[model samples]
Target: MSHPVKLYVYDLSNGIAKQMSLQLTGRQIDGIWHTSIVVYGREIFYGQGLTETVPGRSHHGSPVQIVDLGTTDIDQDTFNEYLAEIKEHYTAEKYHLLDFNCNSFTNDCAGFLTGGSIPEYIKDLPTDFLSTPFGAALRPTIDAMFRRPTPGTTPAQVPTPTPVSTQPMPNPELVGSILQAVAAQAQRTGQPAASTPQATTSLTSPLHPCANSASFKSLLKTHRAVVACFSNVVTCPPCRVIAPIFEDLAHKKGLKSGGGAGAVFTKIDLATPSGQALGSEWGVRVMPTFMFFLDGHKIAEMKGADANELRTQIDLLLYQAYPPHKHTSLSLPAMQSLSLKPILFSQVPNLDAVANKLLSSITSVNNSERVKQIITGSVVPYLKSRSSTKALPTVLVAWTEVTSTLSSSLPPESLFPLVDMWRLALLDPAVATWCAANFSSSPLVTLSRVASKLSIQQCPRPYALTLLRLLSNAFSSNVLAPRFFIGNFRLEVIALVIPSLLHGDGSVRNSGASLAFNMAAFLQTGRAEAVRNSNGGGTVKSDMEDEEWEIEMVSAVVEAIDREKTSEDVVHRLVASIGCLLRLSPFYDTQVSSLLEVLQAKQILKAKLQPGQCGEKGVEKKEVRKLLEEVANKLCA
Candidate 1:
C-alpha cells in the first residue's frame, strides 16, 4: 500500500517554497514523481516530463530531498547552489510567481498532507506579488525546493509521494487571460470594451449630463432634428404641470424620430442675462421661444406654443428643416446664421441650454455680465416691440426674477443689468401685469415699476394691459376674494387708478374703471378692517382713519368719472366702485349728502324714467336710481 507522501521544498534562489503531494494511485510513479520532488541545483525542475538523476541507482534521484534548513547540515553554500538551480529553471520556464518563507512552506506541506493543517506564515501573504519583477518567475523555483520533508521527520508518517492540488486556489494567469478575452469580445460587439482589467469596471470615466446643451447637440446628430422651448415664467407649478408634457413629446417613438439634436425647455427668468450673448453665443432671442437644430445646426425658430401648438410647430419645423434623410445622417451640423434667428415672442421657452449658450458667450461684458447683456440688448427690445399689447404678461415675471437675483446676490455692478430688466418689465403691459401680480406683492419691490407702468398711458399699451383685464376678470369671477385686499396695500394702487377706468383713452380707462370697481368691492368686504384690527385695535373710528385714504382715491376716481361725463354712451362703472366703497364706509352716507342735494336741487333727481325703459338713457337712469337707493339705504341704516 503506497501511502500519500507530501513534501515541502524551498527554492533558495527566489527565497520561497511550496508543497507537493503524491496521492496513492496504484500506477507507475515516474510521471507523477517529477511533480512530487523538485530538484533545485544548477537547475530546478517540477511538473511532468522530467527524468530525475537519483543517487546510487545511477539515476541518483533522492526519492525525496528533505531540505530542512534548521535540522539539516546544509549551510549558506548549499542553500545558494540550490537557489541558483531554481533560478535557472524559473528563468527558462517561468509562469507566475509567489512569495514565501520556511515556516510558510512547512505549514503548506502539512496542510496538503494532513488535509486540515496550513502554515501560519503563508496564510495571509500580501496579494501584490505581481508588483515585483521576481513575482511572476519565482513560483516553480519555490515549489521545487520546498517539496520534501523536514530532515528529522520519520518516514513511517511521511510517504514518498504524489503531488496534486485538491483545494481550490486563485490562478492569476487564468483570470488575466479571461479578462483579455472578454475585452476582445466587447470590442467585437461594439460595446465599450473592458479596460485593461480582467475583472471589474473602472472607477473613472467621462460624465454626460443630458442637462447640458452641448450634450443635447451631440445627441441631435443621430436624430437629425431637435426642438427647444424657452419661457421666463417657470415656477414649480408650471414645471410640474407643463414640463412633463414636453418631455413626453420628446420621447414619443416612430414619429420617424429625428436624430437627437439637443433640445432644452427652460424658463426665461433663468435664461442667460445677456441679449447679445444670447444672439452671438446662444444664437437667438425673443422668448417664449423655440428653435430646431438639425444635424448639429439650427434649422428653424418658433415661439409661444401651448403644449399642442408647440408639438405641432416642432413637427412642422422638423419636417421642413430636417426631413428624413434617405442618405446616411451624421451628428447635427454646425450652426449657421443667415441673419441670426430672431425670437418671435419676448419670452416663451427659456431653458438651461439657451442660458448656458448665452452665458458662455458673454465674455466681453463689463461685469457679472451675462443676463444683463441679454436683457438689454435682446429681450428688452423684443418686448418693447409689443409693449402696447396685452398678451405677454408673463415676460414681466421672468425679468423680475432675473433682476432680483442679479441685484441682491450678484456684484454691485450687476444692478445696471437689473435696471435694464426692470425697465423692460415696466415697458410692456404683459410684462407689467406679470410684475404687478408677482413683484408688486412686495411694497418695496413693486413701487417703482407699478408707479411707472401706471403713469404710462401710451397706446398699443404693453399688450400686458390684459393683465389688468385678467385681474378684472378675476375680480368679476371672484376667484380673488373681495375680502382679500384688506391687508395688501398694493391692490389699493389698482383701486386708486380705478376711476381712471373708462375715462382717458376710453378703452384702457373703461378697463381700468372696471378693475378699480372690482378692487373696491374687494376692499368693501371690510377685509382691511380685520387686518387693521389685527395690527391695531378694532373700532369704527379706526375704520374712519382708513376712510381718509379711501377718500383720496374716491376723489381721483371722481375726476376720471367726470372726464367721460358727457358721453351718455359711457357706462356706470364709476357707480359700482363708489357704491361698494360707500357701503363699507361710515362716511359713505355723510359724504354723498352734498352731491345728493346738488342733484336734487338741479331737479336731476326728478328726471325720472318709467319703471323699465330700455336704452342708453334708461341704463343711465337706472344706475343713478340705484346709486340714490344705495345711499338712502345706507343713510337710513
Candidate 2:
C-alpha cells in the first residue's frame, strides 16, 4: 500500500499581500507563502519546529491551496526515520522566516517523497519580496519581527509598530524614481538588477583575548566564573599547545550552558603592553599560567600547559559554585526517565457555543454590550486567526480588560464561559507569551481572583474545572512556566491548586492532577537538564528549585493519592507528579524524602497496588499498579 503526499500552502499575510502588493511595492505578489507537507493522514509543518497535526488542524488553519504531489511507497516507520533526520536540520532554534522556513521543509519532503518541488513562485517568494525597493527598505523591520527571543528577555519585549504619524516617512517620489531606474536599466541590459545588500551583525565567541587590565576586570565582574589564561601564544610553545584546548573547553562548557551563564574562558597575551600591565597587577610571573576567579576574587592558580589539570580545575570551580542535587545519586530509574513536557488540556470547544453561553449568562445590561464587543469582535477573531498570524496588542488588552471586569462583576458561578475562552486562547504561543510578560494585567489576575473566591465561597464545578484547565494551559509558554513556578505569584497559584486535588468531583481532581504534573514536569526538566549538562561534575541548581515548594507539592500529591479511590487515570497522573517532584531534587534528603516518610507515602501506594484495590480494570489498572509499585520501591530504596 502507498500513502498519498500533498503540499499545503498558506498565506502568511492572509490576503493582504495580494490586495496591497502593487500599491506598496510596485509588484504583483500573490501572497506571502507559508507551506507544510501532508502525508499519512497527518499535516507536518515548521514554525517553532516541525509539528505534526491532523489535516487542516494546524495553527495555520485551512490551507489557501493544496497541491497533490503524487504518492509514496515508504512505510510509516521508514518515513518517521527520515523525519527524525530532517528534524535535526529543521530545529526550532534554527528556524528563520525569510532564509529558511516551512516552505523549505515541505519542498525537501516533497522532493524525497514524490520527485516534485513546491511551485517556483512559492519557493522564490523571499527572493521576490527582497527584490523590491520597498521590501529592501522593510528588511530590518521584518527581521526585528521574526528575531529569536534573547536568553534573558521574553518575546513580548520586542517592539510593536507605532502609528505612521509618529515616525518619519520615506520619500515616495524618490522611491518611485529608484524603482523606475532599475526597471529601465533591466530593459536596456536585458537583465535584472541585483538586490540591495543587507548588513548582518557578527557574533563573537565566548573565548576571546583580553587586551587590558580594564577589560580583564570587566570580564571578572560580569561573569560568575572567569577562567583566565595568562599566555603569549606567539612567544611560548606551551601556550600554542594549550590555547586550542582552552578554546575547545570554552565553546563546550561556556557557550553551550545557557550562553556563558556558567564559566567564561579568556586569555591574556603577555607580549602586549596592556597584558603585561594586567600580569604585573595580578602577579602572573610565569608564561601559560591559568587562574580561576569566582565572584571577582582569585580562587585557584595553575602554572604550565597541563590540559587535563586545566579541565579538572574548571570542572571543580563549576562544582563548587553549583553543587549537584542530592537526588541525583539515588537509584530511581522510573522517576529519572519521566517525560518533562507539560500536560496541557487544549481541546477547544465550539467558539460560537462558548460565545453564546457567555453572552446569555451576562445578566448586567450595562456591561453586556461591552462584553459582547470584546468577545465577538476582539477575542473570537484573535483566537480564529491565532494559528495563522500574531494577535494585535489591542485584542490582548481588550481581553485583559474584559476578563478583569467579568471576574469582578459577574458571579463566580457565571464565570466558567469566560475562563474557558481564556483557556483556549492560552494554547496559542503569542497569547501565552503576552500573558506571561503582562502577568499583573493578564487573565491570570482573573484566575487568581476566582481561585481566591473558591477558597472562601462555594464555587460551581464547571468554573472550578475550567479554572484548573486554564492553569494547566498557562504552562504552554516556556517563558510563563518559570515565572509561574518561582515568581511572586507562586504561592498563590500553589494554594489554589492544592485544595483542588482533594475536590469531591472526579473531573476536578483529574484536572488538578494534570496541573500538578505540569508543575512537577517544569521543575523536573530543569533539574534533569542541569544534571545532564553537568558532565559528572556538581549540577547547577535550577531556578525552578525551591525546597518549600517541592515539599508542599509532594506532600499534597501523596495525600491526593491516599484519598483518590475511583479513577485509575487520576491516580496514575498523581503518581507521575510525585515521581517528577522527587527525581533529581536538591532537597531530597533534607525536606522531600522526610516529608514523604512522614506522610506514609509508601504504605499508601502499597495499599493502592494490592490486587482489586486499584480503581481501573485491565491494562489501565495494570499500568497504574505498575507505576505505584515503582514509586513504592523508590521509597523503600
TM-score of each: 0.27, 0.62
For candidate 2, write residues 264-318 as lDDT tens digits.
7877778765568779889999889999999899999999999999999998888
Give the total clashing residue pairs for model 2. 1
- The candidate scoring highest on TM-score is 2
Q: Which residue segments of model 2 deviate by more than 4 Å?
A: 1-205, 208-226, 255-262, 272-274, 277-283, 292-301, 316-333, 376-393, 611-620, 635-637
Name the top lDDT candidate. 2
TM-score of 1: 0.27
The backbone clash count of each candidate, in order, is 89, 1
Collision count of model 1: 89
Q: Give per-residue lDDT, candidate 1, residue 517.
A: 65
